[model samples]
Target chain A: MAKAVAPRGFARERVLEAALALFAEHGVNGTSLQMIADRLGVSKAAVYYQFHSKEEIVLAVIQPVFDDMARLVRIAEAMSTPEAQQEVAVNGMVDFTVRHRRVTAVFHGDPAIDTLVNSRADLSDIIERLTVMLLGTDPDVTTRIVISVLASGMYGSATDPKLSDIDDGDLHQVLLDCCQRLMRTRGAIGDLRTRGAIGI
Target chain B: MAKAVAPRGFARERVLEAALALFAEHGVNGTSLQMIADRLGVSKAAVYYQFHSKEEIVLAVIQPVFDDMARLVRIAEAMSTPEAQQEVAVNGMVDFTVRHRRVTAVFHGDPAIDTLVNSRADLSDIIERLTVMLLGTDPDVTTRIVISVLASGMYGSATDPKLSDIDDGDLHQVLLDCCQRLMRTRGAIGDLRTRGAIGI
Candidate 1:
């Protein structure tokens, strides 16, 4: 079955994209292998040829987004100043989230997917590093809590109908503004600039 | 089956509490009427006596939270001043969310629940009223957008494990501070305070 599968270099990517759309509409549990296969106009065996199981397909879909998030955090970590790192990381994360809002929603809104995200040590590790980077040194318990809340807000808020019309660019700016206010301290603006991000 | 139910008051509350716990752990799809009954140490017949179906149980659990949030917004709407109302509304919401995070989590996390929440006009009306109250009259797109982001942040931020340890009092303060930063303009703030909330 594997040998007979299409040789397209982007087979995995194609499957993931299709899976995300179907997962979003019908949910991870509500969706099935056959539905995804039908959506792709491929047979069940073709779908199976690409992915070993639904779990593997789901992980494949979620991995790219988390990988993108992890990459942004890594870049922000490379920045010399804490403030700049925070700004760039915050903006990058928000923008990435907006870009992949539906995928993120499918992940967040589905308990099975959520369980998978939380249970995967690799994913959790990436999230932990991002949290540490965001929290910085000497973060009080309160700041830790606020940052956590802000992250969820970014993910969950995008799906809210009241906020539906607000486009990505504006949401990015608004989130940055909120983050700045939450983390504001003396020299914060200068620190942000040093990392190549400007604060208005 | 319908005739075997308990008094409407006790049966409704008992069924809701059991359903919420089960839903939180097993998810809506993972959970069943039998499971809820077992968890509550009751018979399947007893469960059916209380709730006709899983949908009814879910509706019973979700609507109350929406109603409570609506009540909060209504109280905020009655205030003559934005400062007082903002302070009260923000604190109330944070407290409400923290106290009922599990229910909120189920409400936010489950796609089935979210779909149901979206389709329920009664619930949507309350949420819309709350959003409009936050946005105020003549709200420019920016104010509306920021409020929407903040609202999303509020619910999203609550369940994050990173923010899990934050004490309720501290979280409440942080949310209030974030709210102030989000509603930055005087005219917007003024309109938000003066804007009348429509009753459902």
Candidate 2:
């Protein structure tokens, strides 16, 4: 199970909150430790005392969300049946994603993060865990592709300007519907991966 | 139609290319015209001569992709029937999106660009044209949501690492299948705004 490297504290939480706001306001590439310290009314030394570097701070900020996802995956893996497990897990993942849209937005919006994660085997391992959960047991390439597509679709739909006015309830329904359709279509295309996985 | 602002020259194209690479490397907020000039072995003044500001350079980089999408939209609109037009448009849009995945990656990856587009009504107009083309005349809210979801799904999937090794032809087929599924689901949902216009 994924856990925080540092214990939760008022200072760390404050810094993370500031980082999220600043990162969202000015892309992650745009925000700096000095800026984050300034936003928090703290000195750079104080910020450094809590987190060693900007990258560490970013990881700290994103780690909670990632852990939340990992926890969900663990739950899904613990399920008795793939269908029940997938539906619950997929919905949980969607809920987690929607609840943390800013995280999703910031994560996908910064290319630097992509490079960083791709370069680190540890980070890739974390992602692979989720991918494995997303694919269930022994999924083929095509099944993996469909799952990836559905997840991205859900994330994109949440951030889409065209659906900006959609309420959370309606947005959730739309996501559920789209995911179900995607899964069904995958099965129809000689896809055996999600054989009995019902609604997402 | 959205065309290139002017003819391309090596200097200008080189600047734009450098700017994109840097912007993609560092977030748009992190990248500067000076950095781009330095990377290109050109003076900042030379860079300014080609593009006055970083924002202008970023827009120029994305313009070609937008133009291609707009052209495809126009082609789809020119079709005789709505079904035929949607099929053509969907296929064309998917093609353009997949073909220019790198460029599309920029728009989705950089929050600064997303902010710029949202804040600048004029810039948003370009995306508005694509949305209109996708939805057709008087499309409802749900339709827009589905379209956005499907488009995002296709985009995210194409850029996904798991599918990175898959050939383009296979990816295209995957995308086409996803689009067809979207159409089928949208049809099942029926019209949220109107009673008729049901079924695919």
Who wins the lDDT comparison? 2
Q: B14 in model 1: Cα distance from truth in Å?
A: 5.4
Candidate 2: tens digits of C-alpha lDDT, residues A1-200: 13464444777888988998898778787899999999989899999988899899888877767788778877877888877776767788778777776677677646667777888786777677777667878866567677878988888888665566766655666677777777765554453324324421
| DockQ scores of the candidates | 0.29, 0.43
lDDT of 1 by residue, A40-93 (tens): 898989888889899999998887788898898889889999878777777777
Docking class of 2: acceptable
Give per-residue CA lDDT, model 2, range B1-200, as digits (tens).
12455544767888877887887677698898889989999799988888888888878877777778767767876878877777887788778777877677666656688887788775577567666667888875567778877888888887776677766655676677778887766664444434333421
lDDT of 1: 0.72
- Name the regions of candidate 1 deviating beyond 4 angstroms: A1-7, A10-13, A48-52, A79-85, A115-122, A137-139, A159-166, A185-200, B1-16, B45-67, B79-92, B112-122, B137-140, B161-164, B185-200
C-alpha lDDT of residue B164 in model 2 = 74
